[model samples]
Target: MVTHINLKRCIGCQFCVQVCPRGCFEYDFEINKVKLVNPILCLKCRACELNCEGDAIRIEKPIFQNFFAQLI
Candidate 1:
């Protein structure tokens, strides 16, 4: 799974930075916006996507992975 941030549409709200459980999102002072800094740390929890008001973040769901995860 991969997460994408549409900087062009981002409103710099920083909600994603606050909601991510794994500290995947970080605030960029130079850009005056939030950025996903640690993709590997992301838990695919959708907390950032659900809380983002700017609709700037997009995440690819781990569909097939979830099925395999159940079997493990």
Candidate 2:
């Protein structure tokens, strides 16, 4: 799941908004920034984090999930 978006680091490139599969992010035209609007719909795919050119998106996965993923 997405934990945060550092507004200071965000470049408003809309990469996160464009790459999110679940539509968890939206471009806020008023602010010219990306907003995390549907966080509950996030699939923990890391698409937003990977696509963010500004390195603004942060995803928080559980410790156990990380442990299990390393084993796979």
Candidate 3:
């Protein structure tokens, strides 16, 4: 799973880049944008999503188990 940054929404504030513990983001100077650098190391803590003012970032996570089956 990885986080996706919507370039259109991102304001290039670099808040997400700075808050990530795994160093998953990098700033592209030429385009004035943010890029996902290392995705595998992402802890999925949702820090970036919460911090993003423009709602540019989304953390995608797969369902670990079926809820109905587990309940049964």
Cα lDDT computed for each candidate against the true fold: 0.83, 0.81, 0.83
Write down the TM-score of every candidate. Answer: 0.79, 0.78, 0.79
lDDT of 1 by residue, 1-72 (tens): 778889987888999988887898889999888888888777778888888889999888655655454244
Any residue pairs clashing in model 2, and if so which? none
Predicted structure 3, TM vs. truth: 0.79
Model 2 local distance difference test score: 0.81
Off by over 4 Å in 1: 61-72
- Residue 50 miss distance in model 1 (angstroms): 0.8
- Positional deviation of residue 5's Cα in model 3 after best superposition, in angstroms: 1.0
Stretches of candidate 3 exceeding 4 Å from the true structure: 62-72
RMSD of 3: 6.0
Record all residue pairs in model 1 with backbone atoms less than 3 Å apart, i.e. clashing. none
- Highest lDDT among the candidates is held by which one? 3
For model 2, the superposed segments whose C-alpha errors exceed 4 Å read 62-72
lDDT of 3 by residue, 1-72 (tens): 557889999888999988988898999998888888887677789999999877899987556745563234
